[model samples]
Target: MDWLTRANRRIHRTLHARPANGWKPDRFRKMALPPIAPPGWWKALLRLPRDHYVRLFTRHSSVHPPAVGRCIEVAAAMGQVLVTCDGVGVARHARSWASHQTITDPEHTAAAAAARKASAATKPASVEVTELEERSLETNDRIFDVIDDGLSTGEGLA
Candidate 1:
């Protein structure tokens, strides 16, 4: 080794602080410290691209799969509860995919509508032109009363 390296080590050893001069050798020799294990790594690390479905994927399919980035909670004993991303009530579709291979949510309805949009123009339109006679409100007084009564009672007029 270089002279400077040797000289530094020698000086460092001389300058190093030592234990108490009256310390017992037997007690010092008997001193022992417990070993420490490494920290857990797998449970702490979420493998790559944190935004993906890896956080929600179960088996080979994803459950609910988020409707417009919203969380969907479905109970195995109950049914599916799907809401929009903004937490707005969109549509209620009963849990019917029991023992199925894929999950179908409200978002899929839009996709199905888009796929069927191409054929929307293929069907012929049905228009019925009718002539109606204008009548005064006095002619339907009984109907209005019935409707008001139904509304007051929280019941359908029909």
Candidate 2:
């Protein structure tokens, strides 16, 4: 501190031929005030589009049913909700640890099972490639080959 202060004083005195007082006008008085807000200040903020999902992540920790419920409540208050938790606790619990383990939600499990059942019942439509479509795909592949060849040869078609 002493060295720095001495060097600073020496530099100031050498440059300006005077000791540095390090004093200035009141910075508070020179500060500018923020501009006034327009009439509908929260219009943009409050405007919500339809069909949006609120994603909440519980990273690396398993949440019990009550905690999950609370999270869901908060998310629901915001909008459409989806709460996700990423944890190895379930696997660990399954392996051995049997004390103070609150890691299962029966209702959520049942809902997931039902969703799986419904999904399995609904079969996806099979897609068939037409002759013209196959030719177009081949043409696209050739275009990529041409692009790769041109780029490798430095012909500037990349």
**What ranges in model 2 sit over 4 Å off?**
1-102, 133-158
Q: How do the residues 1-158 of candidate 2 rate in per-residue lDDT, one tens digit apiece?
A: 89767765664744563344443434545767669744431111111112111222331212233233222221111222223233122111121133333443455456556666887999899999776534666586576765554464656754
How far out, in Å, is residue 17 in model 1? 67
Cα RMSD, each candidate: 19.1, 15.6
Q: How accurate is candidate 1 locally (lDDT)?
A: 0.41
Tens digit of per-residue lDDT, candidate 1, span 1-158: 58655554443455363333323654777846658754322121222221212222231122222243444332221343333333453334443444533444545445546546865868778989899999887567655664564464556665
Q: lDDT, candidate 1, residue 108? A: 49
Query: lDDT values of the candidates?
Result: 0.41, 0.37
What TM-score do all the candidates reach, one by one? Answer: 0.21, 0.25
Report the error of model 1 at residue 22, Å.
66
Query: Which prediction has the highest TM-score against the true structure?
Result: 2
The lDDT leader among the candidates is 1
Error of 2 at 55 (Å): 13
- Assess the local accuracy of residue 45 in candidate 2 as a C-alpha lDDT between 0 and 100: 15
Report residue 11 deviation for candidate 1 (angstroms). 79
Clash number for each model: 0, 0
lDDT of model 2 at position 26? 41
